[model samples]
Every structure is written in structure tokens, then in C-alpha cells.
Target chain A: MDGIDKTDRKAINFSEKLERISDLWQPRVIAEMNDYQFKLVRIEGDFVWHDHPETDETFIVLEGVLRIDFRDGAVQIGPGEMFVVPKGVEHKPFAENEVRLLLIEPRGVLNTGHAGGNRTAQNDRWV
Target chain B: MDGIDKTDRKAINFSEKLERISDLWQPRVIAEMNDYQFKLVRIEGDFVWHDHPETDETFIVLEGVLRIDFRDGAVQIGPGEMFVVPKGVEHKPFAENEVRLLLIEPRGVLNTGHAGGNRTAQNDRWV
Candidate 1:
């Protein structure tokens, strides 16, 4: 409980957490384990094509659908499902409707990877 | 997708995954993110008080309820809730009914921690 707040000791409703945020693309830290942080983000439409060069990125769908496009092809992930994009792979994430998901990655890793642009978000911003 | 398999690209239904295993206390790897592994396990009743000395352990309730008893008190986590037990903190987990959840930690971290007893589980056994 060293890094945890009193709110964490209570049940964290995924649906409720999603309802708390309306912004898209920015990830808010919800929990941390070891050097990794669990973040919640709402995404819709198309995001910039990029890749995390230093670490793998995990995407776990809490609601709606997620599609990750690679050079070769694309994969659609649904609720209760998860996908891990390996390091250094150029890929883009897109969602038709609003999607809520949890991303697990090392601290300091950018959401947009090295392709910093307008969509790049500030890291470690908790909700 | 270097560290991923073809099956990983597909949506992984948590309930369907739970239906595949019937064992208690034994965790089965479901997904991997970098050096961490997402494991699922069914637990009920009381478990030995233990602690992980090197890294924090995460408990995300996929179904049912989880109660983690700490030295000071206990916290009951319901479905969709999560708790992080910091390294070196002694604690015990209990459930009145069967509980299904995800345990995210570094690969090779023992479920039983330093208190290796009969409850100690085999690691990296995928479901």
C-alpha cells in the first residue's frame, strides 16, 4: 500500500472510472505495481501511427472495441480481451466508437512512443 | 507481435478463460506485457500469510470478491477493483467463495512469495 491511496482500498469500478473522464487519447494513472503503471484511457477515431521503442505496450479492453493496425495487417480486440504490442514495432491504434481500456507499461514510457507530435500526452497524470 | 502468438491477437474472454481451469491457488499465464505476465487463478477460503520481497504484486478481480488481510486490517475488493501489495509487506488473502482474478507481476515471481509451503504454485503454466 506504499504507493496506493485510500480510494484504492475500495472497489474500483471500471465503468465508473471511464465515466469520470471525457477526454480522449490522454491516459490517467490508476494504479502502480513495481516499476509499471496501470493507466486508463478513452480513445475514439484514429490515433497517430507510432511505436514504443523501448518497451512493450499492453492494451486491455474494458469496453467497446479496439483495432491495432500493423504494416502486415490489423487485429481487432474486444471487451475482456487484451493485446501486447512488442517493442519497436510501428503500429497505429484505432477505434470506431469510444473505447475504454487499461494500459500497463513501465513508468516514463510515452503513450505515443517516439512519434511525439500534437497527440503526445503528458505522462503520470492520475485521474 | 514478436513476443506474441497468433492466439494473442484474438479477443480473450475472461469468463471463457476461467471456465478452462478448475484448480485452486494455481495461476496460469494468460498474457505477457514486457517482463510482466498476466496470470489468472481461482482462489477460495484462506491462504498462508506471505510477502514478496523484491517486487509489488497486483490483484485485479475478474469475478467474485477478494479479501487481502494485512497486518493492520483487511480490505475487500470486488469485481473490477484492484489492490497492490507492496514488496516485503506480510499479508494473507482469503475468500468465502471462489474468486477469479488477474495477478500481474514480473515473470518468475512466486505466488506463495518467500513462504514456500504446500500452497506454493508452479510458475508460467498457461491456461
Candidate 2:
């Protein structure tokens, strides 16, 4: 078998990857496309208001509800739904129950953005 | 209500968007982040063997089964699974049944890459 390795060519399963994470709000990188990374995260409760001044953030909900509050309004995303929070807009993500999410953004972007605090998770963490 | 318009801040539901597309293999842009675009497409047959020399391509399966065949191997992606086809790697996607997918790539990339023909879809079509 001189071709692409079978084990290395498997698809990244979201549910399987999410099961490897126990901590909330910590995003674990699963795949990358060019300079962007696709991360899987689980969260409940409120997140700090922050803005990725350099890039837009995408949130695709896999399970439960995710509400992202902007300064003027909010968007509630459920399973099979997604939203793109534009760059430089301050937003806060809140979940009443556990929510599984797939976040897509540039590689170096932090979880807390510029709001950096105790809630900030380490960057480049892969599952 | 001078805030973010409620009507304009709704989430993009994958199932709802897929319902609007009756054609197969035509990816319609649903959202954008920076220079990249997120597209939704329904496919049920074989696609042309092609390669994106400028960037990688991401395929996130929302429904049904999708198998991407590389020159030497293949990756089977099902619902909740994803695979990124690296730049310059020739591949063909096939599906036994209808498959709904979320494709992420740079804005100008075509569905058929450089292997353009009748199968090539119109670029920048939004849903």
C-alpha cells in the first residue's frame, strides 16, 4: 500500500472528538485548512464579552442551544445551525445547558479574544 | 430598536437552506468569514477528479454518506464528520444517496477546480 495511509486519511468525527473533551469552554483543534483551524468545544453558562478584532468567528452548533449576544441584539443557534460573528464586534456567548460547538477561525486567535482573563484557554490545543 | 436588526440576525439552518436547493452539486454560499465562504450543497453522484492548487478544501457532511477518493486512497465522511482535501491533491467525491455538505474554501474557488466543464457550477451563487 504505497498510497495515502488509510489510518491517516480518516474523517474527523465531531461526536467522537467532543467525547475526548471534559472541560467546558476549552476548544480543541481537530482539523486545519490553510491558516484557519476547526475546533470543537463544549460550554454552558456565560462567556466573557470579547471581539476578535483581526478576524471573524464562526460558530456551528452540533448539539444544544447557543446564543451569541451582540451589543444591539443576539442570535440563537441550535443543532444544524450556524452563525458568523463579524470581526471587531464585541459579543458574548451564553448557553443555558451544555452546548457542543464547532468553531472556525484563524489559528492564533484565542478563545477570549482581547478580553484575556482566567477563562482564556491555551492556544493550539489539539484533541 | 436601533440595535442589531432582529430579522437580520437569525441563524442559518442547514436543513432549511438545503430545502431551497433542488439541484445537485451546485454549492450555494450561505455565509462568509473574511476571504472564505461557507457553502451548502446536495450531491448524489460522482464528481470530477480535480485539485485546488491554490488552497485546501473542507467538506463537512450534514447528511448521508460521502466518499472522497484520492489517487491512492479514500476517506468516507458521514454526518457529523469532516475531511479537508489538501491543495494539489487530486480527488473525486461520490455518494450513494443524497448527501448534504457544508463546503469551506476561499471565495473564488470553483466546484470543479481547474477541471472545468459542463459539471462546473456557477461561482458565488448565494442561497
Top-scoring candidate (lDDT): 2
Across residues B1-127, which tens digit of lDDT does each residue of candidate 1 receive?
3544545566667778889989999999987887899998999999999898899998989888999988777788888778888888888999999999988999999988989989999988998
Q: Over the stretch A11-110, how does candidate 1's per-residue lDDT look in tens digits? A: 5566677778889999999878878998999999999899887899888898899999887778898887788888988889999998899989999999
What lDDT is reached at residue A110 by model 1? 90
**Candidate 2 residue runs with Cα over 4 Å from true position:** A1-6, B1-6
Docking class of 2: medium
- Report clash pairs, candidate 1: none
- The collision pairs in model 2 are none
What's the CA error at residue A56 for candidate 2, in Å?
Answer: 0.4
Give DockQ: model 2: 0.56
Candidate 1 segments whose C-alpha is farther than 4 A from its true place: A1-8, B1-8
What are the per-residue Cα lDDT tens digits for candidate 2 across A14-97?
Answer: 999999999999999999999999999999999999988889899999999999998888889999999998888889999999
